[model samples]
Structure formats: structure tokens, C-alpha cells
Target chain A: MAAKVDHAQFRLVIPSQTRYLNLVTGLAKRASLVAGLDDATAAKVSIAVDEAVTNVILHAYRGEGEHSVELELRFTEQALEIHIWHTGQGIRSDQLVLPDPKEYIKHPRKGGLGLLLMSRFMDEVQFKADEVSGRNECCLIKKIS
Target chain B: MADLSIAVRHIGDVAVILPAGFINAHTVREFEEALEGQVQQGRYKILLNCKDLNYISSAGLGAIMGLIETVRENDGDILLSNLQENVFAIFDTLGFTQLYRVFPEEDQALAAVAPERKA
Candidate 1:
């Protein structure tokens, strides 16, 4: 007999609001559980999702016209993948550099930590900007060992 | 999202605030306002009881730092007590443990902010 393998996926479409951070965090938690990740890994995933969604709500939208963010979570036996999409103005990947928290600690700067946290916590982080479709997509992948 | 519930009490010369909830960006403003309100009133000897605070993000920690600066600028200090392990990790990661004095119990925190100790 062969060991059974299963895959699970979940999606959510939420308005670009700070309150939606909880929704994304909850979804990531569930995906981590489905992927059988450890408690620390699950908490890191949730934090990464929170940071990503917060970037969309805070920087992407710029507190202007309303927009919607779509989150997709896919879990397999080997890995967990998160896809976040927003219809706001896209950001340049080059400008998305991760700041060293230590440097900020010495100087005490405001902002710019969210992206850094996401990049640090996620195993792989990718950004795609499609100006034609007005879509900014961020993908995060974490391997389950 | 953690709902922040703040209770402010004057313990002799020190003002002790108990903050209960998740210390995330969504819930940080209330915490900020509570501290700022006290600072503006010239009540700077402050202690925060964080036993009920389950988690804290960088933003939430930043808010605390901002309040620390505000209070210190006015010749006041802020002490934190009963930090959950998760929240303590955040403070440690940011090197805040070096910047602020933290106590394990509420009484110690309150004592740290006593009027006689004000600088």
C-alpha cells in the first residue's frame, strides 16, 4: 500500500482595509495547519501574511479609492504557497529592498519594517507588477520539512 | 486582530495601565492614545501591565518606542511588566530590552516608575 497524499486550497477576497489583516492571518494559519507545519512555522507564516496584506492596505492603496485584495492559499504534502493580488498601483521590486532591522534599531526609523519581515519569514518571496492589468501580485512559498 | 482594552489607574505617584489584547498595527492606536493621553497630562511615571497581551508586531513595538520617547522627553519613564513570551521575543529582537527597563511583575514595574525615582 502507498501512503496517501492530499492537497488543499483556500481563497479569500477582502476589501483593502487594515481589518482584513486578521482574515489573511487566519487563512494562513489554516493553510499551515493543513500542511502540517510546526507551531513556529505556522506563526511565521501568519506574520508573513499579515505583513504582505498590510503592505497592500497601507502602501498599495495609499488611502485613496477603495480596492480589493485577493488571497489564495495552497498546501501540499511538501510545501505551502500563498498568492496575494491587489488591483492598486504596482510597486517596483527594486524599491522593495529589505531593511536591516538592526540599522533601524540604532536610528529608530518609522515604517519599512513590514516588507522586511515578510521577506525574512518567507522561504521564497516574489513580486510581479502588471501595469497593463493593474494588478500587483506577490507570491510566497515555504517548504515543509 | 486583537482588540485593545486599556485601563488606567493612578497607583500613588505612578500611573499604571493594563493593556489587554493583541498588540498589532490594527490595535496599536488605542494603546498609543492611552499612553499619549497620560503623557500630555504630565503624568509620566508609567507602568504597563502586559500579561494579557498575547502577541505584538513590529508596528506595535514601534508604537511603544514612540511612547517611550514621548514620555522621556517630558522627563518621564515607562516600564513594562508581565510581557508574554511572544511579545518578549519581539522586544528582544528589536533590542528594546536594552532601551527600556522591563520587570517580571506589576509591583516591580510600578516601583520602577515611582515619583522618587523620576529623573
Candidate 2:
């Protein structure tokens, strides 16, 4: 029997605070590299993961004290999938609108860029809400060929 | 959380901000304050040297967007230089290159805005 080196999974659970964002991104980058993504793609994956977790901290768990965000990285032969799970407000991907950077800078509002960056860097983004368990999950998938 | 330190140096009328470390949701406040401090002191001409900056998330980008309007309103602009390839890709993907001037070297960025300093 041979060890299945081509497929793996990693999970981390951290406090729902801004301070832990770097840790999540660090693991995302290293895991991406292990999944055979190029350096640039690894960086992009890290950015996408950062955005997703940031949204979870800011929007999902806003004003809620002492919660935890669960992040799982799944590396398959075809793609790298990152799933972020939290118990808070659910997010709808269809509702997101990407701002035009040229015009957006003139008005200068915070937020609305994270989703755009996530969607741009990741090949597929899926959102799921479990009304029964009251949990919301945002999964980011990056295809590796 | 990764540590971020900011040092500012004045070159004529421009204030050059050197940020070393990661700029994510956790560290964006320090970066924002470093930029905001210059504006409060009436130094609107800003230059961000990202030579030592390792990474930035949307939070950091928002901080830049938050301040650009005020800086430009006062007849000054926030310029960037020495971006790592990964950092530049993020800016380019979001079309920041269209709005902000990015130079390969600090001297080039400083020279590009020297005309404004003269006025």
C-alpha cells in the first residue's frame, strides 16, 4: 500500500477576531503550494481565503463575542477547496456587487471589495446556509491542472 | 497576528511611508493611522513604499481607498512604489493601477510627483 500523498485535508478553528487572519492566510498559502499550485496561484489562494475569513469575522459574527471560525482546506487531484464555516448571518453570493476601482476610489467606501477579490482569485465560490443548524459556509475552490 | 511597523520620512513636500510586514484585517489599523497621521499633519502628498511589505488583504486596500479622496481634495495624491510581484498582482486585478501611479523605484515615484511639489 502507498500513502495517498496527492490528497489531503487540513482544518483550523480560531477565535472570531481580526487578529487571527494572518494565521489563516499563512496556512492557506502553504497548503496551496503543497497542492501543486504555482507561487502566484498560492498567493492568490491565500488572498481569497483571507477575504472569506475577514467577511466571517466582520459580517457573520459582528458584535458577537467569543465565537470560533472553522476553516478546512481540502486538496484533491483536480482542485484546492477552502471551506470557512461560522454560525452567524448567512451570506448570499448573488447579492454581491463588485465595485469599479476607477469610480470606487473617487467615492471611497470601505468593504465590497473582499467578495470581488475572492471571486476573482478562486475558480469557484459556493455559499451554503444550514437553517437547521444555523451555520453558514463559504467554500472557495481553485482548480489546479 | 503578524506585526506591522510604519516609518515616515519627509522628502521636500512629500511624506514617504515605509510599511514593513503584513497588512491584513488585524494590522490595517496601524497602516491606516500611519496614512491618517500624515493627512492630519497637513501632509497630503503621500508615497507608500511597499519594498518590505509582504502581504495585504482587502482590509488594507479599503484603508487606501478611504483616504485617497481627502488627499486628492487637498491637491495631493497617494503614490506607490516598490511593490512585490504578488502585491502588484492584487492591485492590478482590482484595477488600482488605473487610479494610482505605481513606480518600480522610490526615486521614480518621487520624481513623478515632483512637479506637484513645485507648484
Candidate 3:
């Protein structure tokens, strides 16, 4: 008999702490399982998901307690999509730059690598900031095939 | 959540520390502490067996870089072996493979640490 597949959605709240990256990683793992992704693909999804959530926690919230972040994961037969929404102040997406490997390795900066990793691992990564809605959204999509 | 564990073993002049599980912010400190303790004891040559290490974050990689600097400042070196492909990708993406001495096996790492002296 073929394995039955069903849609799954999970919502998790992580405090604005670096340690919370683990929580995001775990959630991505679960999402991968639900989406029936292979081991390597699942790992890539996990890394990309963690990077996206970490950006929200670090940049959007800045480890502050005033804002809470929500991670919503959706799984389907075709793909797995993760949405990270935060109530913290929104920043212009165009301002973010992909880390140049040469410059980063030479200087070894602390931040900015998160977005690079996310873009490298995910099939589709989009950042949307809505000032009027008071929420910043980062969407990551990975094909299960 | 991913858990990090460390095991330290001594082999000749080198100390082989195996860190298993995920290397993230929660575990980065412990990882740093383990290496710092070895450095404090004057164990300069170290081999990190990452065969069983399943995951590593940027913070974890940064911790490794910090430890390398710490050990090198005191005339020590660290070699990494058995890096999984996923971990290798992270290293490659961050351009760490160019900076660190990475080996395919523990023996290679140990040999790199203590080269044979010809008679």
C-alpha cells in the first residue's frame, strides 16, 4: 500500500533568543517529514528554515522581549512552504545584501551570512515587509521532488 | 531540538575531541568550553572528529574559528576530519574549507597533526 499523505501546518512561538534557533530547526525537520522529503533535501530545508527564522529573531526582534515571532509551516504534495511573521519593526528588504564570500571570509563579519545561507539552500526565498500591517514576513519554499 | 555532546580522547601528542549532534547557539558555548579547556592544559594539537556531527550553524562555525585563533595564538593547531557532506557544504559556502585543514578521515587528521620523521 502507498503511504498516505496529508497537509500539515504547525505554528510555533520562539523567544527572541539565539538559542531559539534550535526550535526552528526542529520545526523544519518535522515539516520535512510531513512533506516526505529525502534525507539530503530535508537537511537542506532545515538549514534554510533555521536561517530564515534566525534572521527574524536577530534582525526583526533584535533579541528584545517586546515582539514575538510566529513560524507557520505548510506541507503539500508538491512543496513545503514556511512563513515567518514577526510584529517587530520592518526593514527595507532591498537594503539587505548577499554576503560576498571573498569579503566575508577576509573580514569574517558576524551577521549577514544568515540570509546568504537561506538563499543558497532554498528553492525560493522572499522577504516582504508591511509597515502598515506592522508585520515582516519571510517566505521560504522548497520542492519535495 | 538538536543536542550537542563532546568526548575527549588522547592519542599520542594529539587530543581527539568528537563532537556529536547539532552545533547551534545552545551548544556553541559548550563546544568552545571543551576546546578552551584543552588549550588551557597546553594540548596544542587537536583533531575534531565530526563524522557523527549532524548539523552546525553559523554560530557554531564562528565558535570553531574563535577556538582556532585561541589555540593558534598559543602555537596550537586544530584539524577537522569526517565532515559530513551537509557540514561540508556549510564550510564550503562560508569559505572555511580554504581557511581550515580538513581531512577525509581521522587517520589523515592525526597524520597531519604528527607527521612521521624519516630516519
Candidate 4:
């Protein structure tokens, strides 16, 4: 992975609002397509990136005030790597636990499915946060087929 | 910032909400409000025409899910139509396909909403 740092990286910083989520997802989709992805794969990258950034805007910033979410996409020969950065309340690992699809289907809830979709669409998902700096990063990687 | 805009139409007893733009956290509130208005008016049978919708995520799905029981309780249902392939994938990925009725065409969804009525 270290040797693959030669890949081009595109960074987009947008206001942490759900409306701006498309800007990030669009970038991810186009970045993936430019990196040699098929239409379906590009769509997956867009959806996954959309969900990740939405969580930051809704939960991290708690949907209030003005904040910025930076989305960086790196196109390596083998993968499309995405990183999202924000200064908001970072989620605990346990918070990512989602109910079984059957459970939600039986008794539908309005939440607890973002992480599931992200994990399902992307090949790799990771979270890193610094409590002191209040900065959190969500990393998503999808291997090129 | 892209906002979600909802257009309302009445096909007999059903309320057809034509949503345009992105449906996510920022816009789900407005989405819910639109549903709430319908729910308040006792218009429980609803159909969402997503032809102009550019995008959607879990937040938008959640909003739709939150209102299901209420609408069903009123002997009505909220069905979706004209889901772009990419948008439909999210629903399929999340197992919403089994929970909601998703159609390929707006007229098909509207027809499904009220089988007794004419388009």
C-alpha cells in the first residue's frame, strides 16, 4: 500500500450538510470511473461514500451550526480508497452494530443501518479518531476488479 | 447544498409525492414533514415518484420506514416508483425490497397504490 502512494488523490471539502453529500459522492463516483471502474462499481462507491458522509453530517455535527467535511479519494491501481475527515463526535465501534435485516423488517426502525450498507458496499471500512483533537476519519476502500 | 423538493399530486385517494433532488439527513426532515402532512389529512395510501430524485441514503430510507406503521395502521401503504438503478440498489442492499413495494415505472406504482382507480 505504501508503494502505491503515487496514485492521484482528489480532495473535496464541503459544508457538513446532508445536501452537500452529493458533492462528495459525485466526486467519489467520477474518481472511481476515472480509475477504471465499471458503471455498477462506480455507483457502489457513490452510495457508500454518500452514506459515510451523511453519518458525519447527521451524527458528528449533530446537524447543527456550520462545519466542514473533507472527503479525499485516492485511486490506486488495485483499489479506490476514500477518507472522510471531520471534527465532530466520533462513533464508538459498538455504535456500528446493526440489527438483523429480518429484525428491522419485522419491526422497522428509522436508524442503525448506515454502517451495514457501508460495510456491504465497500471492501474495507475503518475508523480512526483522536479524542483530544476531536477529529475523526472514516476510511473506505473498494478493490478494483 | 442540494435540497429535496417534494411535489404532491392526487390520483383518486392516493397522494403521489414526486421527490426531486437528494434525500438524506438534511432533506429527510422535509420529507417526513411531507408525509406527516399526508398522514394528518388521513391520506395514508401514498406513492413516491422518485424519477427526479438524484440520490438517497439510509437517512432517507429511515424516514420512509418511520412512517410505515402509521400508514399501515390507517389501512394504507407507501409504495415507491421509478427508482433509478443506483437508487434502487441501496433499497435492495438494505433489504427494503421486502418491506416496501418498488416499481420500475411511476404509473405502475400509482396503479398499484389504488387498483380500483384509473390513472
Candidate 5:
């Protein structure tokens, strides 16, 4: 599927819990198709969505009571983009700690692949945090074929 | 309802786990419990038939990875078979084929274990 003019946009707001992760993924799947992603690309985009949103659910709340994550899915002619936002502890882009390739292969950690998956499958990835608002956002983009 | 369901069948000494449903952070606990239960029963040779698994996240991957050490320490292996494309992509991206053997068919995974079981 190639890029097209105009895009479809969708939004899903869910509580920051593991159970709600699928809700966001469902939106991402729709966005992928709207972006004209083929089966393979759609699968990657969906998985990328799962990873990005899961990070927010697992890390954003930080013990805060009943926080919600807001997800925005934008399907553009050129890309399928997702913005995951939460008003909790934020990830400073400078402090992004990806798994070390050498060590990861030597001994695959029980966990720690979320960031890697997001970065690998998405073409453009950005992380932002606002100290004043305490907003943590992850924007991931997958280019359409 | 949980997003995932795991049904286990004892095939000789191997535990065949049939997981139906997309697996993610919300549902990985069920998968972990099923695998852990096999470990608890001293049955480490695990074969997962993902014929019905529509999706898998890194967390879901972690659930399986978490149990590998225990299974291997007991001289057993984890074999994966019948993966949907979406689920297989995640496993492939993680280089899981190196950690566990993946078969194109469930019977193949079972066949590989049969020799080991008989020996």
C-alpha cells in the first residue's frame, strides 16, 4: 500500500493498566489499514503500537492512582503515526536506555525488549516529557509501503 | 474474559501448550502460569502451538523467555510451532529462534520431541 492524500485520525483514552493495552492496539490496527499498510507492514505497525502503549501502561503511572493514557492514531499518506501520552513520570529522551546488543545476545534478559521493539519497527520514534505538566509522550511512526 | 487462554496436553513427557488469543501484557500472566505449572510438575520439555494466537507483544515474549532458564536447566527445551505471521514476526524480531526451535507445523515440533522422549 502506497501513501495517499489526506489521512484518517482516531483517538482512544484508556486507564493506564495492562488490560487496556489491547484497546490501543485495536485503534492502531485500524490506522494501519487507513494508511494502506499491507499485511506485513500492518503487522509491524500493530506490534509497534503494542510495544509503545505497553510502555506507557507499565512505566508512566509510577504508582499514581488511576491515571489514563491517551493514544492518537494518525494515518497519513506516508506514514502511520501513533502518539501515546500520559500525565505521570516521564522518560527523558536523554535517559533512554536501550538493551545493549552484545549483552542482550549473550544473555537475553527476562524483560527489556519493549523499547527495542518500538525503535526497530518504527521508522521515526520520539520521546518527550514536560516537567510542568508532567506529560510523558511517545510518538512512533511506521512508513507505508 | 482474559485475552488469552492456554490449554495443555501431556504428550509423553512433553507438555504441549495450545494458546488461543492474542497475548500481551494483560494476558501474559496466564501464559506464564501455564508454563510455570509445567515446570512445577517437573515437565520442562514444552511445545507451544500458536495456531490460534493472533498477536503477541514483547511482554508476551518475555513471558516465554522468563521460563527458558528453568526449562533448560532441567535439560529440557522449548519448541514453538504453528505461529501466525503477526506472532512469528515478533518472535523473529527478538531472535527467539536462537533461544528456541521453531517449527512450521505442530506435528514437527512434536516429532522432534518424540526422539528425545524415547531416548
Candidate 6:
């Protein structure tokens, strides 16, 4: 994390534990605000980042032995970009289909909901996974209006 | 992160759950268990008084989704009341406001479920 307010860049690394989710979300909220996003957009970005980080901990590092999740926040002239890196299982966005809330309640699954919310809240979402290198990355962007 | 605190109280047959603090992946288990406890006890008329709840992630919402079917099957429904504006926005964005009934006040929500208790 940089102390330069004008640059507005941040980097955080947390162990793959759910306990640190709040710290990640707090930084996301502050970073989004510092990047000149409004309160509503900042809140959404915070949630998207939280969901992204939560997925890394719960799904990417499932059953893992003390892994770390790397997160980077960059504010560009056009958008606020958040990148998350993990060394566990990768995510397939093609397989993630957002379900209707009414229909979803009938089946009610715990998985995929976080990703679905992330997709809805953020302006752009991209995923890259290297099965051989065990490096998986997800990037979420929210454009500045 | 402030720990999630849940206090369950009864308003006639309705079991009101008051959860305060953030409900992210870390604390979702406690929220889920509290809801489950009410269901297991066969008390299905649940009202979530979220006046003091500051934040809730998808994991928290999933807990409610996981049990809605059974609760409705038993002729009981989970009603939500006193949601903070930010919390309500999350529910609305996910189309939950349409699936579940939400009231501005706890009294209004309880009256909808326990109409007989109305004065």
C-alpha cells in the first residue's frame, strides 16, 4: 500500500482465512472513495471486492494449507480496477450463469451467488487461470462516472 | 470486524432474530445457525430486525435463501424489517425485495405475519 494519496494505489495480501474479510472490505471501501467514486459506487465496489476475495478464500483455496490472496487496487482515469490473485483452483466464468432470484430460491445454492453479485455490481469482470503454474487472477472494474 | 451478535426473541409465534454487525463469509455460520435453530424448533414465522445490522454479503443472503422453501412449506414465511438503506439496496439489486416481504418498521412486518395479534 502506498502512502501517496494522489497516486491512489493499494496492495494487500491476506491469508486464506475468512476472518480477514472485513479488513479487505474496509480497504476496498476507502480505496474506492479515495479514487473519487461516489458513496453508492464505492459501496458497490467494496462489496464486489469483498465477494471476489471471499471466493478466493472459500473456493480457490479450499482445503489448502496456509495460502495467501494478493489484491491490488488501481485507479485509472476511466475506472477503478481491482485485481485478485490466488494459487489454487481457477474460476470458470463461462460456467457461471446468473439465475433468476425467484427460480434460485427454489434450489438455493451457496456457491456462485458471490460471483453473481460481483458481476452485477462491477462494470467489468475478467478471469485468467494458469492450471500449470497454479496462478489464477480475477479483475473487477467499476468505471468512474 | 465487529463480531455478529444475534438475539432471538418471540413476538407471539414469530421468532424475531436481531443480528448486529457485519455478516460476511466469516460470520455467516452463526447467522445460518440461528435461522436453522428457529426452523428446527418448528418456529417458522421469522422476522429479521436488521436495524442495527450494518452490512451483509451474499453469504448472509444465501442463509435466508437456503431455508425459505421449508419455512414457506410449513405455512410460515421470513419477513424482514428495519433494513438499513445500504442493506436494502443489496437485497433489491439481487431481486430479493420482490421474493420476500420487507417493511419499514418491525411492527408492520410482524402484523403481516401475525395478523391475529393486531389490536
The TM-scores, one per candidate, come to 0.84, 0.92, 0.83, 0.89, 0.91, 0.91
lDDT measured at residue A1 in model 4 versus the true structure, 0 to 100: 50
Per-residue lDDT over A20-125 for candidate 2, one digit per residue giving the tens place of the 0 to 100 score = 8888898999999999999999999999999999888888888355999999888898999999999988877776577776677566587788888888899999
Task: Indicate the residue-level lDDT of B50 in model 3.
Answer: 96
Model 5 agreement with the true structure over A49-94: per-residue lDDT tens digits: 8887777767777534388888888777778788888887677668
Q: Which residue runs of candidate 6 sit more than 4 Å off their true CA positions?
A: A1-8, A63-65, A105-110, A130-133
- TM-score-best of 3 and 6: 6
On the 0 to 100 scale, the lDDT of residue B102 in model 3 is 96
Question: Where in model 4 is the C-alpha error above 4 Å?
Answer: A1-5, A92-95, A130-134
> Where is model 5 more than 4 Å wrong at Cα?
A1-8, A63-65, B116-119
Listed per candidate, the RMSD to the true structure in angstroms reads 3.8, 2.7, 4.4, 2.9, 3.8, 3.0
Deviation of model 5 at B61, angstroms: 1.3
Docking class of 1: acceptable
List fnat per candidate, in order.
Answer: 0.17, 0.76, 0.33, 0.83, 0.61, 0.52
Compared with the true structure, what per-residue lDDT tens digits does model 1 show for residues B1-119?
A: 34668899997767888888665667778878888888878898888888887666667766767776667777778888998765676566556777778999987776566735534
User: lDDT tens string, model 3, A1-145?
Assistant: 9777587677887776766677678778767877888777778788888777666666667757556778888877788999888887565558677889888778764556667778888888887887788788888999877
Q: Looking at candidate 3, what is the lDDT of residue A44?
A: 78
Residue A107 of model 5 has an lDDT of: 89
Q: Candidate 6 on A1-145: residue-level lDDT in tens?
A: 8565643567888889988888888888888888889877778888888898888888878835399999988888888899899988887667567776667656566555777788888988988887787799999998888
lDDT, candidate 4, equals: 0.85
- C-alpha lDDT of all candidate models, in order: 0.77, 0.89, 0.79, 0.85, 0.82, 0.87
The weakest ten consecutive residues by lDDT in model 1 chain A span A108-117
Clashing pairs in 2: none
- DockQ in order: 0.43, 0.69, 0.40, 0.70, 0.64, 0.62
Model 4 vs. true fold: TM:
0.89
State which candidate, 3 or 5, has the greater lDDT: 5
List residue ranges in candidate 2 displaced over 4 A: A1-6, A63-65, A100-108, B115-119
What's model 5's lDDT at B106?
80
